[model samples]
Target: MSRRRPRASFAIGTVKVRAGHAREVGLPITRLVTGADVSLPVHVVHGRDDGPTVWINAAIHGDEVIGVEVIRRVLTKVSPKTIRGTLLAVPIVNVLGFMNGDRYLPDRRDLNRSFPGSARGSLAGRIANLLMTEVVAKCEVGIDMHTGSDRRSNLPQIRCDVDDPHTLDLARAFGAPVIFHAKLRDGSLRYAARERGARVLLFEGGEAWRFDEWAIEAGVRGVLRVLAHLGMIEPVEDEPPPLSLICRRSGWVRARRTGILQMEANLGQVVTDDERLGGLSDSFGRRLRLVRANRAGVVIGRTEAPLVNRGDALIHIAEIEQENETPGQAELAEPSE
Candidate 1:
């Protein structure tokens, strides 16, 4: 007879979860004006065997709801008994903003800009502090999910500090259509998590406040790939993943003139420098300005709204190496609205 290995116990906030089981834990934030308590809900899956602990959190920005579904699907596919390490998933991190359907808290502060927060500070600060202490501190690796802000939509992409070998490995393992070297902004969760000795990957996909099936599927698969790369669970597929285009630099092309903008290129499309990307024209079809690509690159993000103002960002392009050129089918035939 084989001897059974001892199971581990994982605790967060006031909740405790034993190995081979799952539990929902709530980290209290603050009460609403109506006297209702708002808490950050976290789902924990502790594996029987010890390995690397990974934390996957979504909706740090409340309006980015696609990650909520991504997290849900990931949880449904993951079983605690088969995993080797703990999985801490917080689908909704900003409960106040999530409830209000706003990007920022009622106090009008961006939670992503208030990381490593103070306990006695503003609302965003307090929530950030709580997450840093309770969730991020306990994990070895983290995935922060996000979507394009305002009226913009993104091609499913992975953004991380590729300079870090460990983070770069996870980014490539994620198998997104593209991977860009994104610098960390001060006070952002990625920055805070890195400072705490955890490698982090930031995934940007689809648009805010709506679900994109393609983006959601990509997100779920990418996360599972990372987990398998960490030996937390079995791989979803035995075959090698499709190659991901890696870009070291990217920039946005803003509307040169305010008008009704018409795009000639779609997201994930590759264009050469000086190629016509779009045109801004008046309602009567009088061309006001012809938008051209400033440099040769792949379109990773673009605004969905037809109406535009001068200086408004219209297309985001990332410069990739020749060897990492994207396949023709990787480009979308139509823009995602």
Candidate 2:
């Protein structure tokens, strides 16, 4: 005789998902000018066994599509009948911005910067509040997926509070190329979730508005590893990723002059202090200046835009440290928001 107790239905808004089943719940947002209703689509996978609930969200900045793919692939591997915990997969967060291929909302507010918001606030704030109340508040862990924005590309890396023992362990299981010890920003989703007692891992990879196969693979593998670590699923079949490097501090190297750029330093390459990273030239083929690193570190991000203005960030470097050594002071500049 089966000894399983009667499973309760998981409710989100008005939608209830029976235990060991999955449901797509559309939480009403608002109505369009054309009288069409806009809703936040949430994929709730309520597992058979009891365990921790986790959320994986992507496309907070609509142009960052890599995370959307990562969530989709992850959902395919996890089944409601076999898993131990609930997985709230929100594949798209900025639906309005996503529809228009933009990064911000219609009112030009960054959705990421509006968090733990009020119900009667602006559109971005309301949306953030909705997500916080409907999904993140119920979870113990969250993974907010992202990529380099404003025409920049990033190496696959995990950003979290490396000082926290538990979060650090989760980051290690994520198996990104690097684990950046990042501090929380004022209005970020990670910050809001942290305030609500939820641990978060921010995954950065690829460039905006395009799909990167390597980044997608890393994200899929990392999410699976995290799930396994949490005992929500069985062990992953693939070989584990290589050991991740730890970053104590990171900063961006800015352009010296306004011109067309040709980057010489590739992503993931180690460079010495003040080493040449790229060159700049005028439209008339006259050499302008050579861009150099600000410190000894690994190249984690680079600009994809050819034409840049003076003081524009051309490359991002993370000062790496061994796991045994103590983490250094805060970053010269935060690499990501």
Give all TM-scores, in the order shown: 0.96, 0.93
Local lDDT at 145 for model 2? 98
lDDT of 2 by residue, 1-337 (tens): 9887957888899888999999998888878899999888899999988989999999999899999999999999999999898999999999999999999999999999999887999999989999999999999999999999999999888999999999999998988878999989988999999999999999998889888887888899899999999999997866754567799899999988999998887777777899988899999989999999999878788898989999999999998885312222222112332
RMSD of each: 1.7, 4.4
List lDDT for all candidates, in order: 0.89, 0.88
- Which pairs in model 1 have colliding backbones? none
Candidate 1 has an lDDT of: 0.89
Cα lDDT tens digits, model 1, 78-115, are 99889999999999998888888999998899999999
Q: Largest TM-score belongs to which candidate?
A: 1
TM-score of model 1 (CA atoms): 0.96
